[model samples]
Target: MAGNGGHLTPGLVNTRTHLFQAGLRGIGEGLGLLAWLSAVGEEAARLTPERAYATAAAAAAEALRSGTTTLVEHMWPHPSSEVHDAVLRALKDSDVRAVLCRGVADRADPSRRWGFDPRLMQPLEAALAHTDELIAQARGSRVDVGVAVPNPRCLTPKGMGAVRAYAEGRATLARHGVGVSYNPLSNMRLGSGIAPVPEMLEAGLSVGLGVDRAASNDTQDILEALRIGAYLQRAVHRKADLFGFPEMFAMAAGGANRMLGIEENPDGGVRAGTRADLVLHRFDRDHACLPVRDPGATLLTCGSSRTVAAVLVGGEVLVRDGEHVRLPSREPAAGLARRGSCGG
Candidate 1:
């Protein structure tokens, strides 16, 4: 007997992802960070508008099945407006609560530079205009809008300041200070130095977990990321207890919820008034739980995706008995890939 087992709690929130990149996983193997970015960026640039819709739809389904009720998707630099529409349609149809971070890569003025495919760049002004259009339309939708800037090293000080200003504007509307969700695993994989998460958290900046793009992370498993995050930090600090299972769990679940402005109970999370995003995990029979003492600890160190049993958002069961509730497809958005150099 497996001991009639399962446990329920607040659902996990993936604070950052690039759902459209699900189709491009594992292409950058054996490549250095910059080389990988260029190679993958070029391939991502080749995605057509139709392909974007399909990829986003598939990613949403995967997230739901993995017990993620809320996701913050950092969109790629989409060329077609119809592609953006398709993304929104997918989220709405999937019933996943989300924050859509609009991607911007400017390439008109050589002074405003990033190390990405110039082919995908749009004029900064035009990009902002398009962003505004999307944000305006996102009102009353399940999706909210934020800005995704080129990496700091890819921009001038002035350009970085401009990106901050844009992000701050969204902060005002969201009623929370602008904070960043980051992917340490992807950063290390790409030779990007680890973000100063502890320092930022100490300084009161909201930091959350991100699985990044599929090509970058190769998978969208937030729980696995959670375990890696703790181990990575502990190893970096050369301290056995630097980031324990509890802290990382808080980061992926409650900590992320806080950054998104989701309310929490003093007792912990998911009260009557708060959004009802939650996950259930079963570990009784799994070898990972053989000698389980602390469930959270066992989950962090021993569990895998198979541990997840159920997921819910806003009190609606999205996954039950370990299966996703299939949603009917809606009208597809226009297109996914574009081939122009516009800048904002």
Candidate 2:
């Protein structure tokens, strides 16, 4: 790989996303968070199982093309088991490692004033039972299951306690510690407040980069996320040296693995004994990325899907020369267009 003047590094781990929103991209462009949720919820209510499968597959492929090996999908509340199954199947078929967080909202609020949309809510017991079924189905696959609440307002007191107990019983959060997914693009797009990354780092927290859902960020490009994440902190603090390339790269790659309980190469880097989830990039391929004095800086600033020559997950070559091995480049986009939806 070095013979061709290419750089090899660990693939990025997207800590949060909503893959189903691939079809809903560009729907609520200028709306605030609450208004945007209402707008997205209307379209989300119309999502069918086939649409879910197509959108999820398309979104996962987009993430992979941008050098994301693992994605954490935080689905919103929906009563359809078929829709959830379709999303899982799509991720499995795309061959990307994923944690499918089944969304649950116990509180019902018809008006967008206080709580989650009642149309998307299901009984807590039923949601838990369905999640168990999903776990059983995903046992031997590359996908995992977890619980997701849109926000604190979405959960009742009893629901919170039940979710807390369930999470504690299933995973060792206390042992591994907590992590934060710093989604700068999503926050900026939604007009949400900036995350105090420097302070978080000073306090010794593991922070990772996330493109979030395509609906909010409109892209799954981790390179862009890394660049924006660093620039945002620098702009807010008026300090150009706030976050160097190495720290930003770590956050993009494997900084949140401990929080996610990902045992494969917990501390992400190119090393022996780590899972071969890696990406190969050629700076010479892009004129803007040439003369790479610092590979990390070049990647964070000038890199895009065009610079990614190949991507490997678990030593398996899934993308070669910026194209997926098993999926046609146009299939995902065509699938969305067929359903009368546009890509973000």
In TM-score terms, candidate 1 sits at 0.82
lDDT for each residue of candidate 2 in 1-344, tens digit (9 for 90 to 100): 24277888899999999998888778789998988988888878878898899899989999998899998999988988898999999998899988888998898886656678998888998998898898888999888888888888888899999888777778533335568899999999999899998888789888888999988999888888989999999999999987777888888888787777675444456787877888999888789998889998898889988898899999998888888887767988787886443212
What clash pairs does model 2 have? none
lDDT of each: 0.68, 0.85
Q: Each candidate's TM vs. the true structure?
A: 0.82, 0.95
User: Highest TM-score: which candidate?
Assistant: 2
Clashes of 2: 0
Against the correct fold, how does model 2 do in TM-score?
A: 0.95
Q: How far is candidate 1 from the true structure (C-alpha RMSD, Å)?
A: 5.2
Instruction: Give residue 96's lDDT in candidate 2 (0 to 100).
Output: 92
* Model 2 alpha-carbon drift over 4 Å, by segment: 1-3, 172-176, 264-267, 339-344
Cα RMSD of all models vs. native, in order, equals 5.2, 2.2
